[model samples]
Target: MSQPEFDTYATSPRTLTVEDLQVSVGDHLVAVNGVSFQIRRGEAVGLVGESGSGKTLTCRAVLGLLPETGEVDAGTITLGEGATAVDLTGAARPTWDRVRGARIGAVFQDPGSYLNPSISVGRQLVEQLRVRGGLGRTEARERAVELFGEVGLHDPAGVFHHYPHQLSGGMLQRVLIAIAVACDPELLIADEATTALDAVIQAEILELIARLRRDHELSLLLVTHDLAVVAETCDRILVMYGGEIVESGPTEQVLTDPRHPYTRALLSVATIGDWSRRTLEVIPGQPPAAGAQMPGCRFAPRCRYAAQACLGGQVPLTEIGTGRSARCVRLDELVTDASPIPDRIEASA
Candidate 1:
């Protein structure tokens, strides 16, 4: 059978809807609870939070690469299908195998680890094209060169012959990106792909991804903790905490007029300027342990404005404005109150 025309569906301007996503590591411990959002074709959505906040796990679930311990307890992930739709959750691996790399591609953090150290970069790239994408070896090599050039790698032929260890960090990352986009996947998931690079290289990598997205009219799910990165790259942002979405909205709205205390705290700490006179502040207290269970709001323990409402039960994600939602009880009051907000706490490594 011919490859499904996913691009046509992608370009039809449909929404990628996720609802009531709950994932568990084992029988009792939940890693992602009630996570939901939408990514429209040709738009960028960012998932932001500290490490262990389930950002990575959520993306992994979508990619069908969840750890062996992880299980999807409940959720619905719908991808547009040319006037139809594909329900991603509960779909078998065989079904996902067709979509994973062809229609959706992922750029993971740590390019060094993602790429095989012993294999030539060209060989790895071509191998993926042949096995996963169903291209012949000769066709794959031809496409691989084009991909290398597309990602701004100089001397595609020379780099093709080099092993992963022979390339610099930035070059290796670019090569990995080339592999991910080889098939022109409709959705691209970038999980902190630029974190390990230096600032200058980081900027270059981000720009490259943005350029590729624009050029291909691709939808993006960018996962990162850096608010600055979100500000620069994302059209919409979702703030996650303790495995749930705490705040979500247009990037500008959430950053400028934050609703949740946790979202505000994250923004206050992520602001990059004034570092000389002020120490970097972080949210007070560590995130709850994965195995631990809580009765009320998970963020209530660290939230300065937490009240009886927070301690009573789980706060549903409430719509505070058009296309904006947050899981906090006193959201309006918290925005207006002039209580001294603490500086970002320095999180431990």
Candidate 2:
């Protein structure tokens, strides 16, 4: 059966579309539930959530790298569009080998962990270029060095000879970026790619990613816990909570006027736009345990405005305005009121 989102987005020139994706760990724990989203060609989308919000799990599902205990129990993940679209839900290993890294690349939070400590970082990239990219050894070396320079590593030739241990954290991250984009993949999944770097270096890495996206015309799925990062780098945002996308829309609209209480709470505690200081406000409780069954909204337990009605039944994501949706029963009431959402939620709760 075709999904509404799939049918709606398939007509467009999209790079990736994940429809009704449900990921489960072990026998019964469903970590990601009914999650659906699409990334357009050259579009940068942010997947924002706290730890254990299933953001990374969702990305892993798309990458076909789920853990041994994890499996996609339901839904379809389609890459490309129309006749060329490949459904990743049941793709064989050989199909995955061709798609991952070559067609769709990924970079993680810890660059060091992903790299080989013994080998020169440049040599490692060269191996991928030769093996996956099918370039001659000499061509691979020259291309690897060129890539190093492209990612803003100073003295590209010199950096090529440095081992992972010898390079600074920032340098190693740049190497990972170079490797990820080496194949000229159409889609890039950056899972907290800048989380391990210092503030200055983090900004530099983020700038490089933005530049790469523009220069390469790559579709990006950037996963992170920070809203400010998404606000700066993403075209659209998906706010996840308790293994579901609680809210989604344009970055500016979501940041400036968040519809979901969880999103509002995130914004309150987020680092200020200037990165000068972080807001001290904190969400009252930890995120719900992954795969924990709930009767109504998963965030209701912590939401100040949660009421009996909120807990009475399921809360489906409903359209509140143009190009925006929120999974809250009281969204209509809250959005219609003239007062601020947070203020009203505070007073009501």
Candidate 3:
């Protein structure tokens, strides 16, 4: 059969659009609630928050890798835009097989665990290329080698035959990246992809991801707790707290002038900017546990500027500015308050 006129899904400008996603664990515990965001073609968006902030869960829901006990309770995860848009809320295995790797790719923190210890890494890559890329054995091997080289692995032919254990952590990660993009997936999800690496390696990997995104015009969804990482790599940022997006906007805008109190708190503690050493601050209270019952604003208990009204009822993620939203009822008052939102904790006397 002749090739179709065009691939609408691959050409769609909006690579991923998640709307009001709700993921529940067991029956009562909602791990991710009312979360929403979108990533345009070639856009790099960061999903950031402390651990248990539903960052990973939201990504998992999109990738269809949620645990058996966990289920997408509500909302829709739309992949692509217009005629090719697919609702991935409860997509079947075949749909996932078509999307994952081919349309969407992912890289997680641990690289070793994802690779088969007994098999040669190149063989694995070749297999994926044959299956996902629809290439013959010889073509798949050639493409796998090219991908390894594309990911900056030296001696691509030599590395191809080496087992996963033979490669260093960074090398293994590169192998994973090579496999992830072998099929030229439209979206790449990096869930703490560089967290386990040392400072130098981390920087290298981040630069690699950035370069790959630029070269391939791939939409990137980077998940991490490190604000500094996102600031360097992502175009836009979505700050999550208590299973919801507390703030979303351009990375520079969100980092510099955060509107949400939680975002502010995170900034106060984030190690960014100058190299000069300074006492690190910390947010006062622990984050709310997943599915924890909170009638009003989830961050009210920990917010320094919180008032009675904050805890009175449900506080919406109010759009406060152009492309900025904050889940704080006191945003108006806090903005006009003479005293700014002070640093959470200062140096001890």
Q: Which 10 residues in a row give candidate 2 its minimum summed lDDT?
A: 1-10
> Which TM-score value belongs to model 2?
0.92
Residues 1-349 of candidate 2 have per-residue lDDT tens digits of 1112312332448899899999999876989999998998778889998899999999999999999999999999999888878889978999998888788989999899999999999899999899789999999999999999999999999999999999999998999999999999989999999888888999999889888987988889999987778878888889999999999987777877788888888877877555677536778888888678888989998988787778777688888776689999888656533355554444344
Model 2, residue 119: displacement in angstroms? 1.2
Candidate 1: TM-score? 0.90
CA-lDDT, candidates in order:
0.83, 0.86, 0.86
Give the Å shift of residue 255 in candidate 1: 0.6
Clashing pairs in 2: none
Give the Å error, residue 298, model 2: 0.6
Report the Cα RMSD per candidate: 6.2, 4.5, 6.3
* Candidate 1 per-residue lDDT over residues 1-349, each given as its tens digit: 1112223333446547788898899766988998988787778888998889999989988887888889888998877656657788978988888777877888877888988888899999998799788899899999898889889899998899999888888998899888888888888999999888899999999999989887998889999999888888887889999999999988877877788888888977876444464666778899987757888889888977776677777888998766789998776655434555544323222
**Regions more than 4 Å wrong, model 1:** 1-12, 82-84, 273-278, 336-349
